[model samples]
Target chain A: MKKIYLALAVFSAVAIVIGSTVLSVSYEPLDEVAERMNLTGENLLGSPFPEYTIPGFPCWAGGIISGLVGGIIVFAIIRLLMKVGEDGGN
Target chain B: MHIPDGYLSNKVWLTCYAISLPIIAFAYIRLKRKMGKMEVPLFSALTATVFALQMVNYPLGPGGTTGHLIGTPMLAIIFGPDAGIVGLSVILFIQALLFGDGGITTYGANTLNMAITASLVSFYSYLLFRRAFKGEKGRVISGGLAGWLGIVSAALLCGLELGLSRATFGYGLNITIPVMGISHAVLGLVEGVITGFAVYAFGKYKPELFSR
Candidate 1:
């Protein structure tokens, strides 16, 4: 049962990826799609890219850094609070 | 809100990453220390719940607006803030890498907003309310109330972050915060109800875990 469930989840995920890819392909001239959706923003490289305007940045590098950095800081703050709470308990 | 790629400035994103690394390391250490007998079942349940909750994106308002429950607070109350944070971060990371629900660049920011805030706020709220209400009733009420408050706080924090992004990028913060906050406030309410009920149910069935 668990295996079947896992398989279904995997298949669903793959289907979503494929579906998104196909949607992006069909909507190739994203400008038209953007106009259709009444989206206003800079052109970007994904299905909903135009809907969400591409803000100015070193896009790829910024994304990696954001993921890495934001994850770290939140983790640190959580630890610090835990320490404080423990000290208070003591 | 799942922050898509190309929404934020690169420099700001990197800066967030730089700030997060050491913090994540410290959190990992704490998580290792706190893993006890019930931790596995608790963590497993939380991971499944968070993933399931995030799958249901309710309409916020108007066109192109929707919000999902980022279930960190409920996890924190059950597992303590440190473990909850670590666990949720892992879930977020996996979601980014595999599912692509959120931007790769914004995972750090998202993790901080969802897990950190939810866990801390919910944990403290539960602690405070746990004291006020006595016995079985207290545990259920406190659990539900804490979950609601924690989720709302996370939403507000996310709104604040969005406002900051807009300001830093030369967009109007005034326009962003209201849209973001109001939408998330509704999302938070939904999260609060479900989470509160879940906690209440868990306590009712397994009184030993919640009981003092």
Candidate 2:
């Protein structure tokens, strides 16, 4: 049973790695329209890493890397009001 | 669906942001109060899975459009709604800030749709269906149906938000709602199947995850 679970985990990991190649996207016709509709793009702290900037890197690469940093950062957060922190003590 | 920047008008975005404040507070309290050492691994694994799944987009019919598994339903069903909400919020935040999958300005609206709506809808619906059905077979079926409904609702809401921005977006409910709804209504079936399968696999392999 454990081996099966491990295999499934490994399969999933492989799938994700392969899946990374398909991440770049646009909203299609909706996207074309989004460009034309033209609402103010002003943001206080605009996207530090817009998808447009990264031409070749798969979107998940950003997610996986950011997640490492973000996950560690969130431990501090979870402590006050999330699953890892307040109610669930180490 | 990740609504990018400049899509939602200020009115629409700000309203969602305002509406989310109290919901976040409520979820925050519940999130802090639940889970223990035993629940941590499964919780973390599911969170990672959700993040992973969101990045992969599958084609939506022949329209040249695609969508990903909005994987919160399984999390909500497994760990509870609060965890789903907070967990998804964290993922969406990271996606927006770094990957540009979504917009920081539209973050509130995206969170409202994916995190709060999906979490609450799936959690309660799963409970309702599970109670009605009974047994292991019932659990799997319920998980699938609940997950399907959850994503459909989120998609419809997305359509509505985008449609509402029609004044600014040049696409009203007539255009946006049906397109979003139809695509997701189809996509929701896949969500259901995956949710049901996950429920069955976990129940068979690690029943302990459901105990708390």
Candidate 3:
């Protein structure tokens, strides 16, 4: 089960990388359509990571990185909550 | 479908908030009463997983906007409807406030369509399908169908809301409904497959999770 979880994690990471690449590459045309449709909203679909404006990091990359980091943080919080629950029970 | 702030009219968004708030409150109370302590981690984990999965936006069609997995059905199936509501609400809230994926003003509308409607419809449909069918295959089929149906139902509701907003704005049902309906109908298959596979795998590895 542990091995399976590890494998799934690895697979998800790789998939995220590949998926991000594909989405970034293919995003332009769809973005154009969204702009035309006026779906971009207030900031024109602003980068998820607003603070990190490094030269090398693009918007899509920021989105992908922020998503992954957010997922990890959420998972960590879940673990902490679980621990608290367990402690309370004991 | 992550409807931004400006998409919905004030009346429409306010109406959605009015409808959703009570449901959310009810669900939260029910979850607090019904859920076991041990279930907390699993529930939170699953919710976070759904939140993470929503980030992966698959391109819908040529020059069309992308659609990500809404996992409401899967969450409802694994947890109960109440938990599903809570989970989706949290995810949507975080995404809106932090990421700005959906608009702060339109959060209620998005929650109504994606969380409440999708979860309830999927839960009932899954129960119906599971009862009609038989064993392991039945479970998989039911989950897949529920996932697909849930998405389409949410999409339809979203379309209706968008259409109604046209009275204040200009985008009518003729445009909004057809576009949302068609795109969601196609994208829903992916939801089905993902839900089916996840349910099947869990059924195999952790059958106890669903025994209740």
Candidate 4:
């Protein structure tokens, strides 16, 4: 069961990467619409923010890496929060 | 959909913030009151997993625009609706603040659409479907359908919000609604499949997670 879960996770990851790559390079109508609608803008920090993309990697690869990193960060934060809550409760 | 900062006017975004803030506070309070300490790690882990999954964007037909999994249905199924709201809000907040995937100004709108609307819709939809069917098969089907409908519902709400912003931002309902609706409808299928498989796998492997 664990192996199956692992396999599914890997397969899903691979599929995501490949799909993202194709989508990144392909012509996106929504993006065009957004552009037409003038939805793109700067980040909250006052810096220019563009759509999801990486200079050296494909969009999918970048998404995968960033997502994993984000997950780790969130997991750590949640665990820390839990610890703090536990301490407070005690 | 991660609406950028300039996309929504102050009136629109502020209204969204006003609406979403109270709901978020309510969700937090409910989570604190209802959930045990042991559930914290599982909730956090699942939230993080959903955050990661949202990053995986698949193409919608020949258009270059991509759509990602909403994961609200799966989260709601596992942790219930309130937790789903909290989890998705956290993910969206982080993405906007740290990754700049979404705009901070428009964060409220995004939260309302994805976290509140999608979560509740998926949760209730799943419950309805689950009652209609029986056993493990029922749960899987319900989850998939919920996921699909949840995303579409969220997209529809987003379109409405965008359309409302027309007076301030100048983009009308016709433009935003159809575009968001069509793309998300297609993407919802992928969400459905993923949700179904996930429910099935989790049901088979870890029945404890489903225990309330």
Predicted structure with the largest DockQ when compared to the true one: 4
DockQ of candidate 4 compared with the true complex: 0.38
Could you estimate the TM-score for every candidate?
0.65, 0.82, 0.84, 0.85
Query: Which rank order by lDDT, best down to worst?
Result: 4, 3, 2, 1
Local accuracy of candidate 1 as per-residue lDDT tens digits, A4-88: 2354345334333333232212221212222444544331334322221124644343333333333333344434433544445
The CAPRI category of model 3 is: acceptable
lDDT tens per residue, model 2, B1-212: 78877788889999999997688778867665556655655566567666656655666633666667888898888878988888788778777876576788789999999999999999899989988988999989999999998898888898899999976667898988887778788867878888898777777777776765
Q: For residues A8-85, what per-residue lDDT tens digits would candidate 4 score against the true structure?
A: 456546544654554434333445666765655566654222333445876566666665666767777766644555
For residues B11-63, could you state the per-residue lDDT of candidate 4 as single tens digits?
98999999998998798778777877767766786777777677656765436
Candidate 3 ranges beyond 4 A from true positions:
A1-15, A24-40, A43-56, A76-90, B62-65, B167-169
Q: Write the per-residue lDDT of candidate 1 for residues B1-212, one digit (tens) a residue.
A: 55545555676566656655566667767776665444454455445445544544455434444455677766777667876677677767655654454567766666666777778889888989988997767877787788777766765665555556653333445755555556556556766776676567556654454543
Q: After TM-score superposition, what is the CA distance of residue B104 in candidate 4 from its true location, in Å?
A: 0.6
Candidate with the larger DockQ of 1 and 2: 2
True contacts kept of 2: 0.26
Provide the RMSD of all predictions against the true structure, rounded to 1 decimal.
Answer: 10.1, 3.8, 3.7, 3.2
When summed lDDT is taken over every stretch of 10 residues in candidate 3 chain A, the lowest stretch is A24-33
Native-to-model Cα distance after best TM-score fit, residue B141 in candidate 3, in Å = 0.8
Once fitted onto the true fold, the runs of candidate 4 whose alpha carbons sit more than 4 angstroms away are A1-30, A46-65, B61-64
What's the lDDT for all of these models?
0.56, 0.72, 0.73, 0.74
Two-chain DockQ for model 1: 0.05
By the lDDT metric, which is better: model 3 or model 4? 4
